[model samples]
Target chain A: MQGKTGSESWQEVWDKSVNGPRALIDCWQEIPCDPCQEACAQGSIVLSSGICAPPALHAETCNGCGKCVAICPGMAIFLVDRSIGSGLARVTVPYEMRDEIRLGGEAWAVDGEGNYLAEGRITRVSGAGRPGRTMLLTIEVPEEWALKVRGVRGRRKLLEEPEEVEAIEAVEDFAFCRCEEIDYSRLREIITQGEFRSLPALRRFSRAGLGYCQGRFCQSILRSQFLADCPEEDREVESFRVRAPVRPVKLSRLGGEDG
Target chain B: MSLPCEQLDLLVIGAGPAGLCAAYEAAAVGCRVTIVDENDKAGGQLSKQIHRFFGSSHHGAGKRGIEIAEELFGDCLKLGVDVRLSSSVLGLFSNGEVMIDAPTQLCLVNPGAVIVATGASEKSLAFPGWTLPGVMGAGAAQTLINIHRILPGSRVLMVGSGNVGLIVSYQLLQAGAEVVGVVDTAGSISGYQVHAGRVRREGIPVYLGHRLLSARGSTGLEEVLVEAIEDGTVKRFEADVLCLAVGMSPLCDLAAMRDCRMVYEDALGGLVPWHGADMRTSQSPVYIAGDASGVEEASVAMEEGRIAGISAAEDLGSLNSGEAAERRAAIAKRLDELRAGPHSRGKLAAKERLYAR
Candidate 1:
């Protein structure tokens, strides 16, 4: 119940537990799926009798065969080393989605809940498309944070070169203010410029909040980019403007069918 | 046991949206068609989904999903498609043969082509008191309210913010029940904004980043507990009905037991049989359509069934290949509209494994 997400399970991290090259193939769900069990060449995984039984990994007999990792559809399984030979344990989890990232870039690793913590380095990549094409991302970290580092941050070029302001080419439809036509493309231009490097600076240039919709759609979308463009002295962390009518509609006029 | 076989032009398993569509299309092409389903009624998921569907004109946009299913089933009947209800397909034999358990007899049917449209299975979530009697899937709740006109409970706590959870929350309100709120461990609502907004406007606070840590009840569900994902803080919310809308997975046991080509695609919901544009799987003549191939809305599932049916008819030489192509084009065109919108993107993403080529 509280132990797993869809098909991923929860295992408490033990600090004093002996560091081994072994890892438990964790599953959070019992989703009528058998790729992990079927994918296991070493006969490592077994499912209960029910159609939606969560798979239990036979830790004592598992041979570290990468077959199950390649075939798990949920990308929930991972390989971990409690401690590498040099005491720098490397944890490998699957990483997906496109990012402008490269090797050797410093990354802030996060846990299952996505809270950012200690930094790590990319160490290895496994099966691209053997059965499911899940990439085994090997990340090196402190032994204490080995079990906690489930994912890594992408796009560190900004941290590397603070003064650089690269031009953005492709654009999707996003308005700075729902009531106004302030396009995101224009907002980016104004915020990236030297004249408006901070939130207050960009606010002055765009008049983004100067609309009837208050600043619901526009403010938060601009917050991160605005903070990134601004100098360290002007960065103030704020959440997205959570507004009502949170959906688009004439609240006073309710135009949809009653049904 | 070695089962007997009866050869035919097309045989469809699960006479729901997919099977009905496939049977109607195949029969229209002058092919002998047979549709088998386990439920007492012919329409699989359709009989239960009382909500309106979204899509273009072809896919019955704005029409209740169940209505479209009825129309397809009617067309199947008009086309003289032999439909057998309460017929559970036991196993898939080698080639296109199938073993079925019908009332009073264990029958067999073998067609040149077959379509599997088993649809999806509701997921179960576990909490400290999850085994309580008041807990159920959102679909089960919908069935109780819409089909039987019975309120699940006086006050309920919905777990998961996916479309099912959100939609069911609103439906519960319509049925005169109090929905305290929805809790999801994920930070953002997993469903469409419209569905979430409707529930939100009703003052049902959707607690993103909250998990149902535990549930406590004596004989039935009386209280539930939620925990903040951020700080691990726990809070109690009194709930009589605890509905799980965590997610669903494609029911591919029938396909898998037959060794049909299958794969895992999050876009489609879960594990499903791999099929071609015509719905033919690795077993050359065997075809599958609807949710059995992958988890998708009824509109896409029907169109996929039709396309498979037409393709099978053409292959069986029951209709001109040119006629089959025309029907496929029209159905394919309709499927495109259903799968083109923002909502269909997930299904599109799920089928990316197929659409990539």
Candidate 2:
């Protein structure tokens, strides 16, 4: 709610809503998809900005339809109801785990970061439906933690700590071309020397783009390296010269000879 | 010994979703169809997809790609459509002659109509240390995990935020590998937010507006360095595998060899053959479908293949014009529906330009 979740932005909708329970479409990104909008039966979810726009919920019209919860491809949607009791609230979230969470079973409620928030009981577990593979799990939590709880712990752990990556001093020494095994340091040296006037000349000398893949993997990198080094006045980087055998054709097949 | 040459009603290339759909449609309508693919097994990349597809149920949505591929392949076999596996179409002549290289022998076939659906290849991204043995295409990683049952590495750094990157990263976790993070040069996540959400909920970080600068290792990929596009600040992470899901380009070499007019459309994944609404290329009696026409999902490719198959069948007089028009109209309407979303507007515009000429 404070940082990346952007759930605080929906405070106005939450404060103004008079409905008993409703769905919160927490999707913040404008990606080209509409399964959530289509999933709602009441047509409360709308994408006014075409297909790629983030879904906007018509709070009053939304009857807390859990349809959007299971259909969301990103699992970004959740249903929250804070007016249920004095301190009790219900939060329904999408679950794709293989092991199903049991109804009325004790489970650990986690926030967006998958950190332990509080222990809650699973109110309901919906089976796979029109939403295809995604299942819905509703958990009753403290009214204050309704917005904070996003998912539940299944048989497998929700989050795993990422491996530690040490900081390296230099990255330019790495290989740029995977197919031809051309390293960036070598290209940097070639560009600094200015011995070659064109990409074709550099390609001929280094054999960077002459791999089995026909330079599909490294031609762009070569061009970028040349552009990065060239002065603004001389910024024209020529394209790679492609030959007829764009795909790898066995020499024996071409010569009509068999092994 | 020289192989025997035979004439067929239709010859479909590539055996992918598009190719299989085209063969099935054409064969169902009583057009003698034969499909060929370079791989020892058919299904193309579909076999490696373990995630559920998005689309209406009519388009095989809600089904995993492997399931759809099995169903299509089963249908093709039941229809008695001749499927030649491990056979690559070596050459395509303007006269409708196709030279096929099979395991046993190299043979030539003259067909009344041809459907080119060679599909697309994964677009590569180059950075320092990208060529290390551990770094590979996201599709290759998918093939290794889902198909070959091999885990690529313990720690994976995905270089792209597109659907492939996001989906494969999740699959990596499912395969018991750790996904360090997903890095993209774009300012925002390019894939569906739901996919990003799934990864985020799993405690994986999605670094938008970050570019992978280089990979470092002695023999294989040992670490990857990424830079924030906005601030130019660099961060290094230990990753045994670097998956490149930058993008894909339509494999159009076969189409180009046949002298089909090629047009550059970035939206359709670069250098695509210009074709009409019927999927007929500039060359008559020759049609193109699936990624060869443009880069799109398997659902769109299947529909395009159906249209091409019906068009080819009509051209051979096996199907009447009236029936062909109805079928084409129905399939076209479904295609329009599938491409109606914001993500598909560019593809729609590209298709419009392709057919406009």
Top-DockQ structure, candidate number: 2
Q: What is the lDDT of candidate 2?
A: 0.78
- Each candidate's number of clashing pairs is 7, 5
Write down the TM-score of every candidate. 0.56, 0.80
Worst 10 residues of 1 chain B by lDDT: B54-63
Summarize candidate 2's per-residue lDDT along B1-357 as a digit string, tens digits.
Answer: 455578988999989999999998888899989999998888988888777676655656546788889999999999999999988887787666788877776678999999999999887765556668899999999999988999989999998898899999989987889888899989887877667767776678888888777777999989888877787777878889999997887887777778888787778887788899999999988999999899987889999999999999999887899999999999998788778766788989998988998
Best by TM-score: 2
TM-score of 2: 0.80
* Backbone clashes in model 2, listed as residue pairs: A73-B194, A74-B194, A174-B129, A175-B129, A178-B131
lDDT of 1 by residue, B78-157 (tens): 98889989777766766556767675466668777777777776756433565578888898898898778999898888
Chain A: TM-score in each model = 0.49, 0.75
Local accuracy of candidate 1 as per-residue lDDT tens digits, A1-259: 1222222322422232234443444444323345565556656566554323566665545555555554453445666666455667767665433343346556666665345556778766655444314456667778767655556556322111112123222333444444566765677677656576545556656887547745533443455456556666655432222222222333222323421
